[model samples]
Target: MATHAVRVSGLVRSFGDRNVLDGLDLAIAPGEFVAILGRSGSGKSTLLKAVAGLDYDVTGDGDIAVAGEIAVAFQDSRLLPWLRVVDNVELGVRPGRGTAALAEVGLEGRERAWPSELSGGEQQRVALARCLVREPRVLLADEPFGALDALTRIRMHDLLRELCAKHQPAVLLVTHDVDEAIELADRVVVLHEGRIGLDVPAHDADRTHLLRALGIGVAA
Candidate 1:
């Protein structure tokens, strides 16, 4: 059996009277890339938060097991303005590790620049480097590339794939882009009404069926 990096069984989370995640269950094997596809309010970010151990306010009736350290990259870069780029990436980590991680994310030589000196994409790369410096066993990404332009997003996709292949972390990428999910993940999971609506291999799964599951239909 494959070693699992993340496991959640019978998980539940609520806000007010609405259940954001209701009895959700998931398991991710070590080094597996899982992309979660869903519309707004489908609980994708909530689920990632739960897995990252950032949502302590969540009330659940299940267990979550993660093999090692966790890191999260969100839609916003969230870089500290006053810190230099290297300082941002190395926050709590060794400077050498931050340098290497920045290089891994294709941000080499820009370490001394301030956050304001970089473009949106470059800032995001620094964010990626920061998260990666920890050498996390599981990476929780909540639409990390969503704010970038199309070209930058494509480049980021490639960089992410290369980094994941090299680092071999169990990655859970939460996004609304169908094509992006299929392009990046080994398996694509669709969430609907706060539950697993469909889970299928990204390479050979039927796009039409997946689109239908996501409530997207062909234009007449």
Candidate 2:
């Protein structure tokens, strides 16, 4: 049997009377890349937070297990303004890992630059590098490329694929773009009504089917 990098079983999270995640279950094998798609209030980020163990206060009869370290890259770069590029990546990690991680993400010489000096994409690269420096066993990414322009977003997708291939960490990418999910994920999952509505391989996927699952309909 293949080893799982992350496992969540029977998860239930609620905000007052509303249940964001209800008895959700998922597992990610080592080196697998999975993307999640859902509508605005379908509990996508809430699920990711649960898997990442960021939301401590939850009512659930479930367990989330990660074999090793976990890291998250958010929509915003979230780099400290005062820190230099490399320093941002190095902030809480070991000495040399940051340098190697920066190289891995294709930001080799921009280490000395400040957050304000770099473009949006560059800052994201630094954020990605920061996540990579820890050598996480599972990476939880919440719309890491959603803020960039079209061209830059595409570039970041390619870079992300390359980095994942090299590092081989199980990845869960949460994004609203269906095309982006299809392009990057080994498997794509759609969350509907706070549950796993569809889980399928990315290749030759039915986009309309996924859209419908998310309660979106085609218009004439």
Candidate 1, 75-122: lDDT as tens digits: 999999999999999998766777788888888888899999999999
**Whole-model lDDT for model 1 versus the true structure?**
0.89
Judge candidate 1 at residue 51 and give its lDDT. Answer: 91
Candidate 1 residues lying further than 4 Å off, grouped into runs, are none
lDDT of each: 0.89, 0.89
Each model's TM-score?
0.95, 0.95
